[model samples]
Target chain A: MSIMRLLLVEDNARLASLIREGLDRQGFAVDWCESVAGAEHALKINAYDLMLLDLGLPDGEGLDLVRKLRRAKLMLPILILTARGGLDDRVLGLDAGADDYLIKPFQIPELAARCRALLRRPGASLGTTLIVGNISLDTAERTVMVGGHTIEATPREVSLLERLLRRAGHVVAKPALEGALYSMDAEVTPNALEACMSRLRKRLNAAAADVQIRTVHGVGYALFAPVSTDG
Target chain B: MDKAGNRKTGPTGPTLFRQIALRLSGFTLLFAAMDVAIVVVTYSSQPESLAQELLSLEAERVQSATDTDPDYLAGPPGADRWSARYIDDLGEIAGASVGSANGGRLMDWTRRERIAGGYRITGVRSVVRHGKQHWLLMQFEGDGIRPYAPVILDEIVQHVAVPLIPLSTLLLIFNIVAVRRVLKPLRQAEAEVDALDPDNGFHRLSEVTEPREVNTLVRAVNRALMRLDEAMAMLRSFTANAAHELRTPLSIMQLSLDRLPPGEVRDELQADTQHMTRLVEQMLDLAQADALAPELLEQVDLADIGREVVAAMAPKAFADHRDLQFACHGNTIVLGHAEAITRIYRNLIDNALKHAPGQTAIDVIAGPGPQLSVRDHGAGIADEDLPRLFDRFWRKDRRKTDGAGLGLGIVQKLAQVHGGTAMVENAADGGAVFRVTFLAAEPAKPA
Candidate 1:
């Protein structure tokens, strides 16, 4: 499999290097730029899977770049890394066509999970029913079964499993799952997303599913299907 | 002279309208009194002049009668030259002299001449007597003092007194209307100033109409407002710049800390970073809340916000072995922005969880005014601490809690933005209740 590539536009040298190191450890080839001008040059030359942008750039604002790329009709997924407060930058960046936003001082694992979630949206040709070892999920039927026996699940659980099954091997950020489960207008309870994931993990385990939900501490969750040993 | 003095000494003691009315009434009364005094003085001195005029007319009549009657003035019948006599202008003696024989010893009084002592000169000319012109002259000498004050008073009452009442009444009515017109702008300015909210410090006094007096006052007030607006803007910008600069480095520190390996040392560092992050975030929130304009608010459902916050904090409550529940009495609609109201609820719940000990249950109650109160079953707030609970960076036990002491301050500010207030008190059942009340919006119409 080809290595997944990411472009990071950040001005802060220490923060940019740390994030690059962290994503590189997660098996991503990240190209870093310090300004919007440099980012534009990199984008013109390279075909990247996704772009992680910083809003406060030395040469120009990250939002301006997002707008420029979107205006050019580029379909690349862009996630904003902003130090701005929630009231302003978050709303404006999303309105400007950013796929997601992570506030600064965020965990490295969380950023990795978000990148994985963004990458999973494309190139998944597994059809409506996802099979990860013995665990099978039918998106159309909104049902989950292990070894051909159905396990009872709430609607919320069914939707969560569908999201997890799509990115079966990759970790999904808590906020990404939260966004999937609730509409923008819905008020999500604190730790509500974690509680839902916990319940789903218990249900999948009780049903003797082959896959297990593994939690990435200070990050999110991932569905791991153990390698088969019965050769 | 001192109306626009220092604010404490200004005419705020009474309503502007009343002050203007009193001044107008005072001027009117002074003018009216002067008018009355002028009339009385002029009328009072008229009696003496009237007596002199009568004496002059008698002298003129006597001179004209003597000229007409050549024999009567020579010595009428048995009259001597020194005897008091009356002569008609037709050369005939008309009647006995009104003076006593002793009057002859007095000085002769002539027409237009002054009578020295106790005597009065009297004369009458026949304006049309018996179809013949006749003038009579006589002199009286016993007691010249006769009461003419009554006659003068009768003249004054007949002419001047009749119109004085209605004229003064009209003057008074005109004074009142004129005073009100002159003070109309001042009244309006007063009302406008009363309604001016320091929260929206940019507003200025409206322009006053012509008549340079009112314009001067209005201009001064507007100038003061402009200065106040500039000062407030400077302060606000300073706060905004300081907050932004401070948050940048804090964000970098937090991001760097996130890259460390998971361990006790890392955990401790992360906790400190979280504490710093919260302080920065709260400072921003507090500033934003303080700067929020009242007109920008909208209808918000406190119950809905409360329920969501309780649900969101449910996991934390569970982690701490506590129960968090929400109860609503009725429709809790308040006039405020939903985001701000939501933050208020989040802060209250967080404050409760931090302060309440022993895994106590936190109950959130929502009621009318769309009021929301968070009750925590912990040691109640100290009596001395209640007043300062909403003060910025004030904590009862700063070392015991992880809060930056800005959460309640933000809550208080948000409540004020909504045209409401925030209060905290110890509950009777050994806990503390933090309540926020907002202005009630219009009732929702039925679908």
Candidate 2:
């Protein structure tokens, strides 16, 4: 797959460089701009997959830039990174047409995970092949593989695996997983989703996948790749 | 200053209506007394004039009686005390002196003299009765011929005191109405002052329509409020700028630490950075809660906020090996600032997570009074620690210093800002329940 391109609009030079380096390690090609004008000029010339914006820009507010891009009919997903951690600020950022908001002083891995979550939306630019650790699901082919070996799984388990693989490192809420697994009008039993999740967990375990499914009781489930002990 | 002085004198001090009413009643009494004095003086000094008036009235009756019947001898019906006699000449009464004649009357003269027991006033008039010239004489006698003090008092009571009752009542009614009319603007100004919220800098007592004296005070108060508003605004902006300045560097440090190789040193630094981040976030939250204004409040669903907070904090609770659960009963709508309400729930849950033992579930419940409560199955707070739990920078144990102790303070302040309250108590079985209640609001109707 081609490397996904990202535009990083941030004023702080060191922070911007560090973020770019971190995103580069996550297999993203990041183009950095220090001001709204520079960002606008870059957007005019580049076909980027997504934009990472900082609210406090030198020339203009990042919210205004998002609004301008949305008004101009640019459909690329924009994630706001801001030092303003107030709840009102987050609401305002999303209300002004940004897809997601992340408060500052955040971990790079979390940031990358959020970016991937945004890209994994139905119409987003992310490819059909979803990979988390040794497990990968090819959406176009409707198949699941562990360590390059195909696994026998029901269509329901495959769909559940795909949903989990899309948000691999983050907790996908129970209601959200249920919504993704069933049609809106379907009459689902109380334990149907839980039963499916258990079956899928067993299947992954039997196949010796490197990934692990962790259930956060009363909250949701998260998939994590076990840490490699070897250097 | 005057208002403060008035307040210092206590609530029983005179009001404007009382002061005006007292002065009016005083003037009414004074005028009533003066009227009585005048009546008494005039009645005492003019006794002779009164007697002369009675004697003349008697003389007319005698003349009319002689004309009707020449042998009439009985005194006029009600004037038996007056004596009447027919004489051919005025020389009959010795020591009789000629008195003043009545103006515009023929053969009418009055004479007054001291008798044995009293003074006598005699009025004589010449009348041609039965075609013969005869003089008709009438005399009135009384001790000193002066009105008694009690009689004068009776007259004054009848004429002055009786009428003055309704007159003074009318005057009092007029006084109350007039005073209320004059103080109406002041009462309205008082209401405006009462409605003024200290956190809302834009609210001011109206200066227009107030009386001149009260307008001066209102203007002074408005000026003070304006200055206060400016100072508060400066303080809030300073806090906001401080937050920005502090968090930017913290973000940089966190990112830098995130880029480091996986090791114990990096993990320790990351934990320290996380602690600092929590501290900064709590401090900023406290500042924001402090600056929350009444105008920013709106109808918000406590259930929605509770669910969101619990969902967001569940992962953290999971990391600590605790389960976070949320349950909402009926409609949990309340008048509040949405963001502030969210913070309140987050803070309570955070506190519960920190205090509750590992592997226990923390339950967040919203409902009933539109109240949000967080309960954890851990050893309850000590009795002595409950009172100081919400105080800023007051922690139960100083040795276990993971928090800066500002979270509960922020929670309490935000709750109060939304016209709500925060309280903590030990549950009957075990664990501590921290509850915050907001003023309930009616649910919105569908369009």
- lDDT by residue (B70-141, candidate 2, tens digit) is 325544333325666677777876665544433323436666667777666676776666787667776655
State the lDDT at A154 in candidate 2. Answer: 80
Question: Which pairs, if any, clash in model 2?
Answer: none
DockQ of each: 0.16, 0.42
RMSD values, in order shown? 10.3, 7.2
Alpha carbon lDDT of each predicted model = 0.72, 0.79
Model 2 has a DockQ score of 0.42
Best by DockQ: 2
Candidate 1 local lDDT, residue A129: 72
Model 2 chain B: ten consecutive residues of lowest lDDT: B98-107
Error of 1 at B66 (Å): 33
- Assign candidate 1 its CAPRI class: incorrect
For TM-score, the strongest prediction is 2
lDDT of 2 by residue, A11-105 (tens): 99999988999889989999999999999999999999899999988898999999999999999999999888774898899899999998887
- Cα displacement (Å) at residue A13, model 1: 2.7
